[model samples]
Target: MKTAEGLKDIIKPENLVYRKSSLITDKPFSYCPGCGHGTTHRIIAEVIEEENLAENTIGVCPVGCSVLMYDFLDLDIQQAAHGRAPAVATAIKRLMPEKFVFTYQGDGDLAAIGTSETIHACNRGENILIVFINNGIYGMTGGQMAPTTLEGMKSSTSPYGRDVKMMGNPLKMTELVAMLPGTCYVTRQSVHTPAAVRKAKKAIKKAVGYQKKGMGTCFIEIVSNCPSGWKMTPVESNKWMEENMFAYYKPGDLKVPAESDADAENKNEQ
Candidate 1:
């Protein structure tokens, strides 16, 4: 009789000769089955391989569900204190201007505790990329209410449903970040479907490209699903994100800075 691993290999062809996955271990991930983190990990790995940036890129990981991302992403990684990834990335990018730097942060870490750090990073126009995952609830902490928790959503901390009067409205970080002068590009995308995933990959690649060109602060916000925290199956969570979450946080490019006024004037004179 064949082993389960053998059966899996037989069922799925491994003919595609892409770069080997950067994940180092065979241990199963600790994430709940079907969690969006796995998908995000694959996308990031593919992007790193396709862009040939594994050697020069560094990632600052936040203290949320993705805290253990260093174990998976083979590139150089630094773990940051809760909500401090942006600040850490800023320092690294400034010190090593030639290296590509990015921070992977969840909504709870970025929109809640790290709001000031994230905002200031964008305002300062740091030449770095930020991948923000907004899954609505605080997935790492037993489904607590987060700053991005939608109205009428029920979580362990908000069992009675989010009360706008008491809890305040959902914080739209992407929209807010777009308003800052330092931001060169900002877009909100989702990863719940094949087409959406492709679009998200494009957005991420664009953000990385902007940083490589010395453009300040490229941000991509991805609307993901937390199946375990949402008390639903993975399919159900995807449905919820599409039906409810998208209505509130419609995905699109929120900002793109034009050429510097000085550069444009110089070109015109020549």
Candidate 2:
């Protein structure tokens, strides 16, 4: 067996593969054991730290599971009324154009009551990042059905499973926003697996870069798992999300800037 000092030599900076972002507070996450909120928070913090935007970034969050986001992120965080995050984010960005502004919202808050605000924000082409977490149900305020809830999915309000005819089809908010002219980038991603996390992180970084360039609104929808709300093990929720949620809300970019615009931006940067 190696002594403690001998082990330290093997665990030098050269062997360091990963480290927690300083932007993330040391407080333990309040999310459920299998919830995806923790992973999403970590990546967002990492992105801000990696870009050296900790002091210049401001995040807006509304009611729902992410209501306590201010406790985890070490930055200027604004709390908006339930389902009003987009409006608040727009105001903040307009007031402080030099600062990086983003809204972190859940599906129920973003797609239901705040639907008009979200649509108008994108339509107006606000230069902000919208980080949307879609877990189908209201995770924090009981497992209630949300606008993005998959058809036939069970929730506290829809005990017998969602009825499409009665409750209407699940809304594809991401797809809806992608069609708006104000949005420059729109993508749907997940963080259920290691590879998925990598892709999601890249997507976030790209959105931040676009926001920095004032390229309209950049929206990223993270299809997350709500184990406690879904009444399943974390592993089971991931599997169900893959089989059901992915089928309806397919992943990948829904919108991107035209080639000419992208080329022009790239050249300008150079």
Over 91-144, each residue of candidate 2 has an lDDT whose tens digit, in order, gives 999999999999999999999989999999999999999999999998888999
Top-TM-score structure, candidate number: 2
TM-score, structure 1 vs. true: 0.88
The TM-score of candidate 2 is 0.95
- The stretch of ten residues in a row with the least summed lDDT in candidate 1 is 261-270
Worst 10 residues of 2 by lDDT: 261-270
- TM per candidate: 0.88, 0.95
The lDDT leader among the candidates is 2
